[model samples]
Target: MTPRTFSVVIADDHPVIQLAVKSTLSAAPDLHVCATCSSGKELSAALATHRPDLIVTDFTMGRSEGNDDGLRLMQRLRQSSPATPVVVFTMLTNGGLLTRIRETGVAAIVGKNEDPAVLRQICLDALAGHRQRLSPAIAGLMASAGARADGVASPLSPREIEVVRMFAAGSTVTAIAAYLHRSLATVATQKRSAMRKLNITSNADLVAYARDHGLA
Candidate 1:
């Protein structure tokens, strides 16, 4: 006898992550990618259309991020489909922010650092009533999240924060240096340091982070 098919809905802003997730889940005989959405608005619409058995989503989604994208969306999911299990598929490692994720009643949390195949196993486990599980790559993340449940604290120093805000707001590195009366080298270094602290190696990702943090 064939097992009951479980349709899955995936929501992420990145095409690569979406593709990876779709590919991973498609390998499972009983799992199906019923829909994929790139934004909260789209996810809401997909939920209405597909009414999927499981949802895999990200904390931030495109330009609408920092708009209470996490908590509010999770709240909506709970209200709209409380019985459907939700699995957070992300690469975010902010301990404090991850704590807030746990409060949202999601069924599971899987990091991008782990093989997407792990998500498949965790997805099956979540269906069996497990609340959450963490992979080895980010196992300590939740511990930190648990210890600092108060709230997310900024990792950037004040200078780094200033540098990041200016860069994100379209100020050129030279311009920011001139305006702040700092050497170009100093300003540039600060910008690079900030990016590193945020785990962003590319300018595009930095801009996305800025948008997600309301700095852009």
Candidate 2:
């Protein structure tokens, strides 16, 4: 009998990074690259068209037709393709953000600084239904950040983090409220509450904070 092959979809905005990742994944005999996307929209379309067994993607892919930020993309992807596990490729250093990504139930996360071979191993592991794995750097960050890595002890609720991310992307409070189906007062309160937790006093600082955590 022929060996079974697992199909994969790779998403990244950078042409060079995309090429490198495709090359790495394609080198594995049991894996096949079904599609390569440069944006979240393209990725979604590819997911619908190919329905690959695995997804290897960057945390952020610039502005696309849909939500492409780290956490929102994960949420949308989960809703759209519940069975297809994901493997994130990123350069993120923020423990809170990494924790958020992990919570999204990704199969694995490999930092850009890690060995390229790690991606292949992670891909195979994900397809095998193995437990999730994080690169050394990501694990170190989570360990160093301690139990506070996630919002349970970290301060910002998942919804509040979404608000801050939208705000950083230039969405006005009213616009965010409308898009989120949240009342203006509630949106404002969430933003203020997030800021207060982070000790952010201004819009500029909040944006900076978001950027620092890869939220922007």
Candidate 3:
């Protein structure tokens, strides 16, 4: 029996990085670069057309037009194809960014400055069904959040808890509506209610509260 060829799509704003990644992956006999995109919109369009097995993208792209480019792309991919593995190769190693990426269900996170061999290994591991890469900083953040038990518990209604959990899970208002079988306006209302109950003003705060409460 013959093994299936793995098709990959590369999305990054930098042409040089895109070329480098394309060159690196091109060396593997079992891997194929199906498409290359320079923006989140292009990436989404390519994915819709090509349906690649894996997607490698940077953490930010100017083409997202003032949004967390890679994160938005990941969310779109999740909505369109939940099983396609995504590997984020970026220089953004901040704990908050890492946590956000993890919540978006990216298969692996590799530093752009890391050895190419390490990046390749991570991609290979992801192709073989591994998920979650623990950088020391991300681990420390997770550990600290675990130790803090000051988040809301037992007082919020089940709907409120669901709203908070979905919010922490990186679902936008529309996504939450779809997930909960509610209208967009209803979901937004629930989100606001949840925030008011927790006295949080931003998604980051909501995520932190959820993390502290072990809701994520």
Stretches of candidate 3 above 4 Å error?
Answer: 64-68, 134-216
Best lDDT among the predictions, by candidate number: 2
| Residue-level lDDT tens digits of model 2 in 103-136 | 8888888888888898888889889999878877
TM-score of 3: 0.62
Candidates sorted on TM-score, descending: 2, 1, 3
lDDT values for all models: 0.75, 0.84, 0.71
True lDDT of residue 109, candidate 1: 76
Candidate 2 to truth, TM: 0.87
Residue runs of model 1 more than 4 Å from their true location after superposition: 63-68, 144-216
Give TM per candidate: 0.66, 0.87, 0.62
Across 1-216, the per-residue lDDT of candidate 3 in tens digits comes to 998789999989899999999888877778899999888778878888999888998866653232335455677777877999888887653343455566678887777776676767677778899756654433555445442122222445555656666677677878767756689998888888888877889888889987766455
lDDT by residue (160-195, candidate 1, tens digit) is: 765675677677898778766689999999999998
Against the true structure, what is every candidate's RMSD?
Answer: 9.2, 2.5, 7.8
lDDT, model 3, position 130: 76
